[model samples]
Target chain A: MEFSLFNILDLLGTMAFAISGALAAMSRKLDLFGIFIIAFVTSIGGGTLRDVLIGNTPVNWMENTNYVYLIGVVTILTIIFRNKINYLKTSLFLFDTIGLGIFTITGVETGIQNDLDPIISIALGAMTGTFGGVIRDILCNEIPVLFRKEIYATASLTGALIFVLLDELQVNTDITYLVTALTVISIRLLVVKYKISLPFFTLDQKKSPN
Target chain B: MEFSLFNILDLLGTMAFAISGALAAMSRKLDLFGIFIIAFVTSIGGGTLRDVLIGNTPVNWMENTNYVYLIGVVTILTIIFRNKINYLKTSLFLFDTIGLGIFTITGVETGIQNDLDPIISIALGAMTGTFGGVIRDILCNEIPVLFRKEIYATASLTGALIFVLLDELQVNTDITYLVTALTVISIRLLVVKYKISLPFFTLDQKKSPN
Candidate 1:
């Protein structure tokens, strides 16, 4: 009952993830089945891992099989509309950012509900936020975006930590979620736009030079 | 202590599955990462799914850490040895067959140990036995090989039934396992050699004949 808003965020997260997945597959010139597989993994992969880690029984997909059917529907439509698709890169990044934000919030909420410590919750949130894309990239045979991109997972971790901090301050749940989502989205969007990546040896170099 | 043999079988299973996955990825003309992805899934996918379904915590690969490392090692070696891999198809098939037999037996045994009924055990066994290749094919963007060729899942089911029946007769566990594995391998290998596949259904054909 406390997680009444979960259903909405869950569906939102899944839909956004699916769109991003399909776009990524398209960029790779994958066929219908390949596109579908990527879409399925991207949409559910992080949450699935999170759920298993948390010992959630029956899994999220089995409890509500409609997610499965929804993915199927989206995949079919993507294939049918393949030739009509344009703006390959930007739209995908946008969808991916949205998914990352939504899933981060939910994952943090779940860990909090489980009464995990603040640090563990933050880790869970980040895992929930980024693992799907990691899995998708790994399956597609690419180094995870986490490893290659600057501030990808780091952005998620930052947002999750902020959320935990705000919750400790007794902030309202809705506001915490909104602010956290914005935090994740803004950080990721900025990183993409400015090509701001994690400092490679920057931290170490500063310390050494000083 | 008695499970020492089970550990050995699992190691063999991993090797077998990895080999099959590598070959399949090569056939699909995947890049190195793609080959590794295929190999990883082929080696661990079914067990992961089963663990998830059965609420096995941490999942095996995530827990062991070694399993993931092993897959990576195999993938790298497979790539470097690609020139020598041409002669490996026969060995790959043999290893795959052995893995299938061992996996089917282990899966059914796990189900039984968990006190699941015969039907659920059969389902789990089949799922555990065949889901790896199914996931592999899907990742490669193909309809699963098992669906089209050699009565693959059917063979797993056949072994599961034999295990249940023999256990009911108070058969020794080792003998039962050996018998079931041999039965499955025989059926699968024979079918492969003979090019035996399930009959195709045509929409124009009448099921009324059944």
Candidate 2:
């Protein structure tokens, strides 16, 4: 609740995710209520999951009305600016990337605060960074891009690992956060730009027929 | 944790849910690992969400290895008896209904134990009973049946509401649970038997185009 650089980035991340959720819902042609629900989940679903896993009671949004108000505002704005926002795809993408970076760090730090294992912390970070979109895609009745084509979770994982390593080495907190967030943002941008993706496995045609 | 009738019913519910999940995954033609993951989530997803929302840390499955083992065994059994299981559609439906009933009670009790309002407890109960399948359907890239059709969530909600009403009157605990579970099971069975479903809503063509 204190105003800080981290808090500011968190708000930005929430706003970005909310807009993306609204856009996705609009594409699905959901009613206003459905769009609101999807946007709400897409913005906070990951953090809510993380907090739940860590046993953080009442979760974050329940404690702070600001997040709820923020998402509501963002959803309304996204709806109003739908066509104009389509022209700003690059800007939206950048915001989403930034959100991914910030959220991953937030998850990792939360895990550390809870004294979880580094491996689990990294998993939490990637999940926190990516699961909102996963939830969004699921509600829209599509395979999550995370499990299919993107290096999204991998990027979050990489940043989380780096953050943990730097933290373990007792690096300056501010520098560690900056480096980790930048690393995630850069990896996502580069991989997406290059269309890089992990190889997908397919069942043998003779063994399994669909 | 106590070796009570409730505990027995809980385990049975877990097993039934796991089998249903494995069956669903198999039908999807997912590989063995995918099937296992699906089964695991399907059995525990709702409860995990419930526990997390209420700030119960480490979640239920983490605190108890029995659920993990039960799901694993159930998944293996389901795979081995997949064809035979298909012949037992009636039995499977019965088990699923039983699971819905028991899990609803468990969720409502947990919420009440945490001193939540009756309305919130009822919501938790319904969510606990139904969200596992919601997650399963989402993972399978389909619209959740809960939203589209079926009296599934409705049955759970009805049972939850009845349970809350009964509890408010300080009814006998054993009788309360039994009545609640039976109410849920009977409602689901009747609904399905008669092909009853909630009416669907569609946006007007003039208002929205796809």
What is the per-residue lDDT of model 2 for residues B1-210, given as tens digits with 9 covering 90 to 100?
776776676678788788877877877899999999988998898888787788776788899899999999989988898888655556556666787888999888877887776766776788789888788877876567454435677788789999999999999989989999999999888878887765322322222211
- lDDT string, candidate 1, A1-210, tens digits: 134777778788888888888767666655444566578779987788788889895457645656767777876675566445555556666777888998998899899999999999999999999988887776665667888664778889999999999999999988999899999999987886788766456343454554
Candidate topping lDDT: 2
lDDT of 2: 0.79
In candidate 2, which residue pairs clash?
Answer: none
A1-210: candidate 2 lDDT, tens digit per residue: 897776676677788889878777766677564566678778888788888778787777655667878998998888776766533435445656777888898899889988999999999999899888888887877667586554778889999999999999999988989999999999877887778877778976685555
Colliding residue pairs in candidate 1: A150-A197, A150-A198
* Model 2 residue A39 lDDT score: 80
Q: Against the true chain A, what TM-score does chain A of candidate 1 give?
A: 0.88
lDDT of 1 at A54: 93
Off by over 4 Å in 1: A1-3, A202-210, B1-45, B57-87, B93-210
